[model samples]
Target: MFKKLLLVVFIAAISCTKNDGFQPNGDVLSIIPLEKCENGFAGEYPCNDYDLLDYISLEEIGGIGTKGNDCWGWTDPLDNKEYALMGTNKGITFIDITNPTEVVILGTLATRTVNSSWRDVKVHNTVAYVVSEAADHGMQIFNLEKLRNVTNPPVVFESDYDYTGFGSAHNIVINKTKDYVYPVGTTRSGTYKGGPLFINIEDPANPIDEGGFINYSHDAQVVTYNGPDTEHQGKEILIGSNEVEVVIVDITDKSNPIKLSAISYSNVEYTHQGWFTEDFKYFILGDELDELRKGLNTRTIVFDFTDLDNPVHHFDYSGSSAAVDHNGYVKGNTYYLANYTAGVRMLDISNIENKTITEVGYFDTYPDNDMAAFNGVWNVYPYFPSGNIIVSDINSGFFVIRKSGS
Candidate 1:
């Protein structure tokens, strides 16, 4: 989330329909044949050991502006079919990726308000919640099961529930372990000062507003604390990337949530987003602006959380490119990173505790130069049961990818 107030203002000034002279190629629905990573290249896309399952362009998905920000995956509890929820400037797109070769564009749900270049979506118990930076764009909750009843393909879908309790959120966090959803980076000057909103979504349609943290958070990952920290093992822990520092809080009791601790790293530009290892002993963080501001190759910091109250920076892993790291998620021992200009990179964190991380594979959706700019894959969804990867790009629209020979 490179969403500082200055850039948000500049983007909201423009219009989604206003053409900036960028035209897409794939206007009709079509499927791309599987291209395996051979001799360092998959079709025209550069890669190591990752293969391109399929690709859908912005024009094909009826995208007006070349702006996509976040992505999430939803697996139907009814049939275990995997679906990709891609957040665009105008709305959130739903695609049926059960069959990577024959991908289906379910449709798009228009934003709660006008377009503003940033949208985030997350899934919890058959419901998908979406948020955007557009003014008055409240959290949109859509029924995931409805995807099975679209009579016409690619229609302009609508949300099942619209919660306007708060306006314009940057990202949505859900700890499925409990019946609550956290919306962080909301409208500033609110009671919580743009911190995480603790809303009880026990009834997906009727989300009740509970109390929340009172600090601005760019992005965060909240867990039920089943990690190594036995002191607060069962508490609701939220690790927020709050601009300059990472803040940890105990939200098990929303009425009086406690701040466990906060830590900052060196050469910090902007503390963007982070994910905990499988063990939760280590946290992997990304600095969104360090590559461009500090001229550093895609930097990723690893923090030792053996002591949650006093976290320490263990080491930093530099990617092969100078592109910015947008969003990353850990699926088992592999770290799936959405490198802004370099596309999606997979890192082997099996030995991360020993300060040893390796680049396992990559699939470059942006074939252009890997610069430290924000014009490539925005997010990646790798938690699907089918082992497929769903990637959302700013210039391109949708993509389905997977590791070679997987």
Candidate 2:
């Protein structure tokens, strides 16, 4: 009778454990906690199962390059091959990511100035424009085509053109449709006043300085879309993240640009960076210090850009992790975010009109809690043709991943 009782208890314990949940290697899979829903906004659900893939190691990639603060992927329009451009404190590293399983580091171009923690890259035509915050660092232009026939291992190459005048730049954005490259947060002491430096890169090798919109800017995005500011139809507009508020400028005429207006939401922390939807209907803004200042976890503000001059607060979404958002981009209806410590999260914003965002899928490359600190994923490039995502981690280096089922 005692033996029978022991068997029953053991069976019951196993059943209970099976019903509780599956914990693989001590990592739990479920939606993260969320703040109480407010203002009729349904909070985002925690990600179910996020696969953390650490495919490439920095030590394996020639050992000359370190993990960077930002990354951008460019596809060779001629051959449809994909190349990854990763920004490092020392320089920009290029990799051929055609086979994510075996990423190849083609080459690297060291910084023009002393090494610094920040670097940004943008591609136009067949050339890449790299900028960094190092002292006296100007934009370094490189012909990406050099990666086509690289037979040797990773080698450093001299820049094709060094546009020097403005020293350190915090970020670089390209208006591909207009053939203009906007370099924001530039300074040499106070001549340009660190706004957005506009350069006409119609000719990659020779970039002409086309003036800029000055104000104190940290990051910006230039677009020629028909949204909010209709009076400026078919005109180029610059949406900038100033230290205090988000600024909109009419940069159609680079020589005589006009500051249209500025917008600010409730929790006005540092207005860091933002992106517009593919349809150009809504503008998503990120506050760098909101998590620290207001104690709100991962707060992302959305603005209705239908009326450019008078932007309306659409809604706000908070995530489970405490990590602060650095840079984000909207491709189609999906928003790919670089949450510093939480890693790269992909959100489906199809319901942005209803002020709702659901965390469809995520890959936690950082494997740490998402706090408002600069320790993990800095930027992610999800534009690769194969749907492969390239992420740059401040500490872990570059990673190339695709959906597990895909």
Candidate 3:
């Protein structure tokens, strides 16, 4: 999914030993003091309105040498315990963050294939499906319920099931309402040409291939439509972030999908990732290389999807820092963003209709510099009901933070 493959390749070659100082283990490090942003610094890192509850280094979760990539969160419905499903070069790490201060690294599910810098995890019905760019890394399905009984820490777990329909995928999109999973960024020559591969995961373990779209998609968000567009209400839709454009596909009927629309914007560098607002009225996108290519601060583009067929660019939001934006998720009126090098930034989107978005809070895990680079927070999971934000850092591992007074 990286547009500058050679840039990442060069960085990977020279940065593989970035974690040489640390050692690998499943031990929980000491908790970070509850400190608020004071004069732009939260204790040692830069922050605003947010406080860090805990921080775990890569060595504590999996080991040294390996690095973190993408992350997602799961709250066990039965006990209401929150867990962070973090991705590392090793595999998916299950961390018990119910007690943020005493966070525990329960265990890790080894990658089915080899190690790759890119990996993504998404959960549906107590199961998590993970995919990586590693060759032949196919999606690894794990019963998240297994984390409940992780008494012995640091154990190596195996995937409960593995789907080999496609060799490698950059990301996995889940439409929980329809019990379907779409694996995007697959092999370009596959049946779908790296587009959305529809898989029925109603049977979490046994995924049946429904169909897929042939247009290559780098990342996508699939949901049962119920937005401002009344005509397409209740239909299953896929909003894809193709390299050059944002594609809207109606996947209500998997057998016969429809390409509703495809749109691009100015100064396009790479259509990397995006998410729909809670109401599904606006789609926010982040171009992976635009900050570097355009020499602009962190830029976010919003699209008005009231009429999916004739969607228009609503506005562009530029952050104060020049960090590269990765993945972002919206909850209610807040947009939690994983800003590479700039760390995780929380923006208030309540005034989005007025073309206004204000940064409310942030925790800079990577305080080195907020330049346009891919060496910091990879992604953030803000959907956790506990109000605890899970941030996966490319260098520092994982962090759990909350609003200062929340």
> Per-residue CA lDDT of candidate 2, range 338-373, in tens?
988887788899999999998876666566566677
lDDT string for model 3 (107-172, tens) is 889888889998999999899999999999888999999988887897889998889989999999
lDDT for 341 in candidate 1 is 88
For all candidates in order, the CA lDDT equals 0.86, 0.76, 0.85
| Model 3, CA-based lDDT | 0.85
What is candidate 1's local distance difference test score?
A: 0.86
Q: List the pairs of residues colliding in candidate 1.
A: none
Cα deviation at 392, candidate 2, in Å, is 0.5
Candidate 1 least-lDDT 10 residues: 1-10
- Candidate 1: clashing residue pairs, number: 0
Candidate 1 residues 240-335, lDDT tens each?
999999999999888999999999999999999999998889999999999999999999999999889999999999989899999999989999
Model 2 regions more than 4 Å off: 1-54, 61-67
Clashes of each: 0, 10, 1
Instruction: Give the lDDT of residue 335 in candidate 1.
Output: 96
